[model samples]
Target: MLKHAPSSAWFRSALPVLVAWFSLSAGACGLYSLPPLEEQKARILSDQITLRALTAQAFLEAWGEPTYSHSEPMQFFPVASGNYIPRFRVPLGESPPGWDDSIVSEQALFLGYADRGELLGFLEKRLIYREHLPAEQIHAIAAQWKREELFKTRLEAPPARPPSP
Candidate 1:
C-alpha cells in the first residue's frame, strides 16, 4: 500500500474546503452570484448613464446627433448669482446687453456641458452606450431607430415604386 506524505495529506484535505470557503466568501460579498436571467437583464436595463469621462464626440456617436442645442449665458460665477469680479464689486446686470457675456452650450436629449463646447453629463431617456449596455437591449434600440428612419424615408419618397426592368 502507498501513503501520501504529511504535506500532501494536508493539501488534499485542505484544498476542497479552501475552494468552498473562497467561493462562499466571494458570493456573500456580492462579487459573484447566479441571479435569474431576467433579473440580470433588468439590472442592465436599469443601469443609468454615467457621464463622467465621456466626451462630446462619444456622446454624439452614441446618440447619433442631439435633437437640438440650447445656449445660456455663461456666468462668471455659476454657483453664486452675485457678480464680484476679483476684488471688484461688479454688480449683476452691469454689463451692457451683449458685453462680457459668454454662452455655455449643450445638446439634448438632456446632456449637460462644462463650458461652451465641453460635454459634462447626461440625463435619462436618451440612447445609452451600446458597449456599456447589454447587447440584447442596445441592439433592440438600434433596430427600433433603424425602423423609424426607414419609415421616415418612405414617407418622404414618392408612393409608386420605379418599375423593375
Candidate 2:
C-alpha cells in the first residue's frame, strides 16, 4: 500500500466527504456553463441536433407555427420592455446619457450584441435609462458605437449586505 504523507493525510481522509460534497454540488453545476444560445441554435438548424434533443418542433407543434422566422445567418436578438434594465450592478446608478457611467444601458448592450454578429443569448428584461441624450444624436450614436467596440467595461454592483437587526 502506498504511504500517505502527513500533509496529504487531510486530503485522503477527506476524500469521501469531498466526493459526497461534489456529488451534491453536481446539480448546481449543470446549469452553470451552458453553451451560448447562438451555438446551440446553430447546431439545431444544421441538423447536428434533432427535435428530440431540443423541443423546437414539439414547441411549434404544440403551439402551432412560430410567430416569426429569422433569415440572417449567425445573428441573435434580444427583446425587452419597461424601465428596469440589466447590468445595473452599480450602486451609484447610471449617470446622464452621453456620459460614461458605472454601466451601459441594457438596450445598448443588447443591440450591440445583435449588431456585433453574435449574441450570448436572448433575454427579455426591463431597462431603466436616462431620457435625454447629453450629446447630439449623431455624436451620441457614435459614442455608443465606440463603447460597443471597447467592450472591456464594468459596472459597480452594490455588495450584498446582511439583514439589519
Top lDDT prediction, candidate number:
1
Residue lDDT tens for model 1, 1-165: 558556988999999999999985663233543444454344434543332223344455444453333222122211122111210112555642223344222222323222222222222222211122334443454454456546756554437878999
Between which residue pairs do clashes occur in model 2?
Answer: 83-127, 84-126, 84-127, 85-126, 85-127, 89-156, 89-157, 90-156
Clashing pairs in 1: none
Off by over 4 Å in 2: 1-10, 16-24, 27-29, 50-165
Error of 2 at 70 (Å): 24
Worst 10 residues of 2 by lDDT: 70-79
Instruction: List ranges where model 1 is wrong by over 4 Å.
Output: 1-53, 58-132, 153-165
- Model 2: what TM-score? 0.22
TM-scores for every candidate against the unseen true structure = 0.21, 0.22
Q: Judge candidate 2 at residue 39 and give its lDDT.
A: 55
Tens-place lDDT digits, model 2, residues 140-163: 444554565466334532246899
